[model samples]
Target: MVAPSPYQIVKKLKVSRVLVFRTAQRYRRLGTSDDMQRRGRPVTVTTPEAVKAVREKIRRNPARSMRKMAKEYKMSQGSIRTIVKDKLKMIPYHGSHLTTLFIDEKIFTVEANKNGQNDRIIATDYQSACEKGKILNKTSHPASVMVFAGITADGKTPLIFVDPGVKGVALGQFSLRKPIMDLPARRRPRSSRQRDSRVVSRQFSEFISAVDWPASSPDLNPMDYAVWIYLTEKVSSKNYPSIKALKTALIKKWDEIDDDHLRAVIDAYPKRLKAAIKAKGGRFENYS
Candidate 1:
């Protein structure tokens, strides 16, 4: 019987056209779908024992360099890498520009959250507001607004507009109790901050509890990665006449983000942890 064409096979199996074509071509030439065995020397260094040793060494100290692992295991660096990647399913990661100390702190936070010690994590940050218009002359500073916002697993809170020239005191006036109280007691919701601003230290100390977030690690914050970026992009796309206009745009955009997208961003926390581990506590480019 004549073999079916690649298109026919793709329609029948619902597989990719390229995959089906390759398989059909192989079958016609070799009379089988399996690949023809290639002639080459068998791999001897990547034995079961070597794979186990590599895994153990990584488990003991994930920070060990690949070159060091190669020397310790008495194998070529390429072999060690292959064993770690192909067999052990490990990826070498380096922390972002943040120092090793900050990376360690982030890893601990991620692990603690994963283990359910802190069930709810909210990310909060301040965006330096900017004015859009032509700069006709030099030394003219653009009028800006300081916008504060927070995001949780469920969604974002209302935009907190900070008054001009007021710094940490703004947080003191802004109420965080409503958001915290809304969560169940069992969740033990906690917020994260990069620094102990006066408001956080004085006011937050009195009522709200927050975790010490890594200052340099914006990737760990959904506010930085998801909400702020999205909001800034939307706000910047159109020109606003005054700070009030910008504030209105900010609130509208914040409200427009649906729950589904917010939940997706929150759900990515575990994947981010895995990416961090794979990168060996380094900065990861892609979380999704």
Candidate 2:
């Protein structure tokens, strides 16, 4: 039988006519279809060592500029950029300035008012205390302290200080155990929202029993509406040279917060929940 024509092969094999013809010609001439080494300059800069070095630098500081990296690595800026973009698959991002209002505004309301009248829902969060002058002016390396605290309907808990640059397992080990253990079992409300980090901790589920709350309802949290705002205002009014000084001032101000004021804030939860429901999980106008 005669061999099929290239057109017939193209139709039968569902391949391009050019590819079929090329394959036939190559097989007749070279007796194999493997790719031959073509004449071109070999790659020099994108070596395995260079890739490892580039990855290490990026791991060390994600925000490091491509120009700075090129200067340090003695490679062309274009080469460094290619490594970052194509080889490393990283895109440079200017960090966003996040605010509570922005987050609360985005949260879609969930059905979370099963026991609307219960006063056991606690609220917890992290607040950064830095010199207000430096923050306002946007100048020099500003020292800050990450303060973790919570509030119940009755009153506030003692302030917890998380060390700078600590997260994940380190955060779990350094900060979570004490405050959770110290919480009076009587006041350990049936449910609470302590932000994503606290919720994700390995020990969190073990100590704090499983309780669900609407992810987007910070407006419902007394800590966000009353505690943090008040603390931030009080802390910002003074200046501190170091985090230690800032922490001392924070503890002082926290102690000064009257139980009456705290109770009032806690009592406002029902109204906030009602407002949240009225708005269908959007930002409540009454939140202050």
Candidate 3:
């Protein structure tokens, strides 16, 4: 194939004039535009020793800032960031700066929730996983485990498995307390709509009657709109043999989730609320 001229390359790539000139100059001198070493001070700051030091510091305190580490090590924040991110493959999650804690409950059954798109399976041509009996069927009554959890910008709470047939009055005994200052916003779909409404109403009837909460505002709840769906997708990839197995998998995956993701979910709250307002608090899921 004929190599494109510099003008053609510039037009096709739409790169800056300076970059095109530099590439052309390099190619003329070295017969290749690929990276070539230039004479400069060798990078000694992000050495193996520095990387090990940074990794240990982060392990001790994941919430430590690059600025603080840089000041302590007498290195630039840029170098610290590079060591933390490129060298260690770690995401810089914002610390416990935000105080709001979003909490919710979800039930996991032995049979995964296989609805519409989630039911589709990948397989050979004209021979899908469904044909091989990989798909799970819906059950009228499946063994289930209900989990209660909370998340903030910092991290998540330990998964609390609710006992079978536990009522709202009994839920208070779980002692949902964390050391962090939090404005707890609990959104319980099952208990709110079906079973525990009466019990919950009896306990806080004034609060229920006084506040005109949106009747169907899942978009307003972070857990309802994001966290639960994410967890369900991760946990329900296959049918669990028993509730015990499902709970174990849930715990494993839940703990594996990093604070970066939790922080991002919390950060999107304002945008979701704005979209909700634009939709007049009705079916805002499709707004953005």
Candidate 4:
């Protein structure tokens, strides 16, 4: 195809620049907005000591979430997270770091630029396995063990901790060998991409499906998003008779969903697809 006219190219470039600026301004506006800051009451934890405490906690335990620290320290999590990322500089844990370590550093490289520099590899874990490739069975009970479990907007359900259970799909441990942390419905988390599993674990490959991956998206899974909305509504209003009752309720609701409700969700997938593309491959939080 022929290139656009120079005037048209300039116009397109201008629009792109304006769009970038607008996005930045929107984020800035959201940050400076009063949505989080209370309508009244003076701030208490603005002192340098409190700020230092937040950074130290973040540095010591990079995987410890902001909300958890806020609860334990009696501070706001958003404030803590913003301060940590802006000042201390730590990436809140990603799925790539969840394993005990990589299985082989000899050849495996992390997802990096098309140029392929060795700098992309995470220094310590070039090769690791999930405690010796134990989940090889297609019939495994948690056939889909949602890593994190907790109450959400509607009901108590197993949080979709990790999914598409493929390579790079290891569950993130909160501690050295601990399970992942679960959060309530009020918070949404940022997730990371998983790397492919090593070929030596070919035994588990029978269960992996390419369709499950869906074009580098967190937005594709219906059970991950739409179903959560239903679950939250179902559980929050009524008190569960017991923990077992909660489990039964979750299973039932999950099964009871019919085709039409699912189709409506399928219909929205394109919009999400567009948003992801427009965002230049950025995450679009289902909650947000």
Candidate 5:
């Protein structure tokens, strides 16, 4: 018998010419029009119910681990991950920065802050690593002061000096002595850690969802990834003889920070989110 023309195939099969040829080619190669059996194990755990359960769990704790969920749900970690990524379309954000102010704390030392740029020095092989200005005291630690601050797209909160050896409970009360903004609060690591205390948690009860504001994610905060770096670079430009001097430098530079720079950092936040998604909730520093 004669083979049917493309027009006849399309007219009878009700498919486009492209699909008709594709099907014909598949059949010719595989000796069948039906789908070939795919290699590897078939999907078994990522069901609608599983997806719903996983969604509810993550809604309760966005930082909930897939391994923990797998144990709870009696499924493999891979299965739980698939439900999160493919079905629920969730990304494991390091921290959420969608707040009126991005708040964080940093400890500044009296000694020069040793970083990649500042640590490098021109020296011969015989030179000591800790010669003169680079010398670090072995017995005693450098005098350091912790500072807490909040940043907005337009301005920043005054640097609040945190007292030495303050506990979480005391720190929360001390830091939030005055309400900075009328809007809901979201904070970086310090506040996130403070929420672990029952007293501190109560203080943050009026704040945003804990699930959305889990700790240890500085990458998302402009303060952590951007502003702090700038401040550190400027402050570490010269070694301070005392914590008082470091504090003065910090306050002065903080006040002088250009509003335009703040706006630019805040504006880049959405792009950071996209890069985080592309990294599948993993480290996205290189991707960004």
Candidate 6:
């Protein structure tokens, strides 16, 4: 090897010094070199006990509002979400039923309930209009009644069909139940490979049948708003044929829904309940 020239040595030293100076400047900006803890607002001020307190409140009632929850438990929504999510391990919930949700159409209201009070008189869908009549069952001659379905996540909600006269969503809602009682048709999970085994397809897995659904919580029921929409479709236009026809139609439509789909809705109950309870009775938001 040939010896390097003095000029080459000087150039190499200059490049090394420039690199060190640039790195030092970057560290100074970040406050690491000066030992300065960069000042910023704290992300979390609530303690773990506070997290647990809010979590317990949510565990008891998921239909309550965040405003109420914050007031009652003294925490913010971010804090609440973190506690409920991280500490409680609750999943963000949505409805299980994969049905064609009708949103664009507004059902005419012959009756006014506390929820859907807007009588905007907008034009309605024709097919929805007919279905609305079946469910809404307006008397037309002296109309002042509404047919609302208060469904819950736990298998169609038994509370609804029982009284159909509760006020709060939890009390007012009914669980979706199948018409017949039989051995669960779901298959079992096994620790085996596909190549070696003949798989038995059960209609429902143990999970599918054994889910304990939440009742009347909107977090789980995306269709809860849709159900409200279903009611609006019924009484709108103030032109119904008869009450008997509407009731029969509503009951019929309820029966036609698939059992497995209903179970899926129930699966979303915990998340729905949490949202409703967190919001303290505010409208159930469609987080999806």
Indicate which candidate wins on TM-score: 3
Please give the RMSD to the true structure for each candidate, in Å.
20.7, 22.7, 24.5, 26.2, 19.5, 20.2
lDDT of 3 by residue, 128-191 (tens): 7658555558779988888887777766667888887877545543434431223234321212
Candidate 6 structure quality by residue, lDDT tens digits, 98-130:
322111111222343322344332337756655
Please give the CA lDDT of all the candidate structures: 0.61, 0.63, 0.74, 0.47, 0.74, 0.45
Clashing pairs in 2: none
In angstroms, how far off is 64's CA in candidate 1?
A: 40
lDDT (Cα) of model 4: 0.47
- After superposition, the stretches of candidate 4 with alpha carbons farther than 4 Å from their true spots are 1-196, 199-218, 283-288
Alpha-carbon shift of residue 198 in model 3 (angstroms) = 11
TM-scores, all candidates, are: 0.41, 0.42, 0.52, 0.26, 0.49, 0.27
Q: Write the per-residue lDDT of candidate 5 for residues 92-176, one digit (tens) a residue.
A: 7676454456778888887766654456665554255446345533225778889887777766777888887886566655575
Error of 4 at 247 (Å): 2.0
lDDT of 5 at 168: 56
Candidate 2 segments whose C-alpha is farther than 4 A from its true place: 1-137, 168-174, 190-218
Worst 10 residues of 2 by lDDT: 101-110
Over 1-288, each residue of candidate 1 has an lDDT whose tens digit, in order, gives 997877788899899998887877898899999986778986689999899888888889889899998898788999998998999888888673221111001000001112124333333422221122121222235566666656555545556665556545435334344544454543324443434455446765454344654445537666656666676566754445677777777778778998688778777867887887788767787673
Q: Give the alpha carbon lDDT tens digit for every residue of 59-168 in model 2.
A: 99888889998999898999998898889898888784221111111110111112324423333422232221222332344555566666555445577776556653
- Per-residue lDDT over 177-254 for candidate 4, one digit per residue giving the tens place of the 0 to 100 score: 221224332322333223344442464756556655447656444445665546555543333445455555555665
Sorted by TM-score, highest first, which candidate order results?
3, 5, 2, 1, 6, 4
lDDT of 6 at 90: 80
State residue 41's C-alpha deviation in candidate 3, in Å: 49
Candidate 6: residue 38 lDDT (0-100): 48
Candidate 1 minimal-lDDT segment of 10 residues: 103-112
